[model samples]
Each structure stands twice: as C-alpha cells, then as structure tokens.
Target: MQTIGKIASVGAVAVAAAFSLTACGGDDTAAQPAAAPPAPSSSAAQAAQPEGRECTADDVKTTGNFGQAPTITIPDDCDPPKKLITKDLVAGTGSGAKAGQQLSMNYTLVTWSDKQKLDSSFDRGEPFSLHLGAGEVIPGWDQGLVGIKQGGRRLLIIPPDLGYGQGGNGIKANETLVFVTDAVAVPTDKS
Candidate 1:
C-alpha cells in the first residue's frame, strides 16, 4: 500500500508542473498488465440505460469479478471519449462514497490508446488509501470516484482534460485512461 502511494507521489512530482495540484492529496497509481479485450462502443454500452445522458462513443471493456484485478481491453481502432465515463461493474450496498472522506481502494490503470498497464494496487497485493477530493490525486480520480459505494467495482474512462493533461511520468500527452477500481472501504470520522 505504501509502495503504491510512493509511486503515485512520484508521478505527482512529474505532473505538478503542468496541472494544478489541488483537491487531492496524491497522484494516480497503476502498472503494466497484459493486454485484454476490446470494449463496447458508445451506443452499445449505453443504448438501453434509463438515463438520457449522451454517450461518448468509446469501446472500453473489462473482465474479471469484483474484489479482484480486472483485465481491461482496448481496441486497436478505439476512440476515446471527451467526457469522464463511470461504469459500475459491481454495485455495493454500503454507504455511498462522499468527498473529503478517507477512502481505501484497489485499482488497476491502463491506457486507452495502446492498452498499456500503468499502475495497479492489486498487483502489489494491497489497497491504496487517500483522502477523497483532496489534492492527492488527479482531477479524473477526484471527480470520477465520488458516489461509489463500499465494495463496489467501477470502471472510469478518463479523458485527458480530467486526467493528466499533456502527460508526464510515463504517460503520453493527451492520453485517455482506463481505470478499474474497487472501493474497499470508506471510513468516516465519528466525532
């Protein structure tokens, strides 16, 4: 867990010069994993959903059950979205995650363009902990992680604007990111 934090901190150093390091305590964490499968297109992914939100036409997919590392697949002809997309693979029944809370989560990160694995807490056999909405992480994570319940598994497709814009620390410029995160715990302060 600490190793993951250190890794994120290193990335943060690389990104701090380009972006505002606010509303989070650290940077994102992920590692390289084997290439997975391709994802569904925008229409296919959100065709019958009850909500009327506009689909971004991305075809990102994932495999593996909740509480474990997911295998994310990016197509060779994939098109990344302009907005942040959050898809819950496994829903949790616990309280919803809120901003400013201490959150412990297991996650895997990959690139949408080339399907390269960046960092993963699951690979390290530990969960990463951070203060939600603090300047500890990227804007994508700070925004995408909200409302996820404890024990839930979420897939966040983050565009460059919400992610590391222009890229740094092993990431490419204007790259799209794929993140499979499991909300392990959200502990509240009972005063």
Candidate 2:
C-alpha cells in the first residue's frame, strides 16, 4: 500500500511537472517513464488550437464512465484559455465537494501544447484521495476541482499561473494544461 501511495504521489508530481517547464520546450527528460510512448510530434500544427473562447462543459468531448477513468478528447481547433477554466462534463447528484473535505478521484492529464497524455490515475487501477483546496495538488486542481459533486466528471484547462508556474517540474514553463477528472467519492471524514 505504501508503494502504491508513493507511485500515486509521484504520478501527481509528474502531472504537475509536465505543465511547468518554459525554457526548454522540447525536453522530455523530466517526464520520461520507464517505458515511454513514442515522442510526441513537435509540429505546431498538431498542437491544441483553442477556439478563442473560455472552455465550457460543451467544449470538451468525453467518453467513458463518471467517477472512474474516462477517455477525454479535446477539439484540435479550439484555442486555449488565458485563465483557469472548468466545466462539468457529467454532473453528479451527490453533495458537492467543498473546501477542507476529503475527495477520492480519478484523473487524466494532457498537455495543451501537444495534447500528449501525461498521467492517469485510472490507468493505475486506483483512485487518489486528497483534501480539497489544501495545496496538495496544483493550484488549478486545488481551485478548479472544488465545488464538484461526488460522481461528477469535470474538465479543467489551466494556464501557467494556475499550474506549476515558471518553476516547472518536467513540464515547460508557461505551458497550458488540460485535465479530465472524476470525483468518485467524497468521504464524510474531513480529517
């Protein structure tokens, strides 16, 4: 269990790092997995072309289950937002997430630059739990994921300021980030 916890934490860091680096736009050294997928195409045309508007729930195209790992597809032609934007792809009927509450969730992350998948909690076959608004995760996640209901699925598009900022972990500086998350369980215990 400790090993799994460590891996989850590392995965979270990797997700954060993948959105951080700004100077070296093409370096993959920090994000390389033990068995990495093929290098992403560096062509600017292949990057996410945001459609000059704030992303809404209707803008994201998602498939798969709510509160579990799901496949998210962003339109290539859409323009990225300058600030953090979040939309509920699937609304939940349970109580909404609140600050200081504990939440268990599954998530998938992709870079807005090249749309490369960075990390996935669902792929690991486990969910990660954290305190909402507690700074345990990136600022975008900590802020954007709040108010989500249990069993809800959300899409978050995060700009650099709300992400890792200039001191990125593995991600480039000033990079934009995209995340698809499912709030699987909101435990009653706030401790």
Taking all chains together, the TM-score of candidate 1 against the true structure is: 0.71
Give me the candidate number with maximum TM-score: 1
Counting only residues 3 or more apart in sequence or on different chains, how many pairs clash (N, Cα, C under 3 Å) in candidate 2?
16
Per-residue C-alpha lDDT of model 1 across residues 106-153, encoded as one tens digit per residue: 888887655788777788777877777764666677788898888889
Best by lDDT: 1
Estimated TM-score for each candidate: 0.71, 0.69
lDDT value, candidate 2, whole model: 0.63
How large is the C-alpha RMSD of every model relative to the true structure? 8.5, 7.2
Q: Candidate 1 — which residues are off by over 4 angstroms?
A: 1-58, 188-191
Query: Deviation in angstroms for 59 in model 2?
Result: 3.1
> 178 in model 2: Cα distance from truth in Å?
1.1
Evaluate model 2: give its TM-score: 0.69
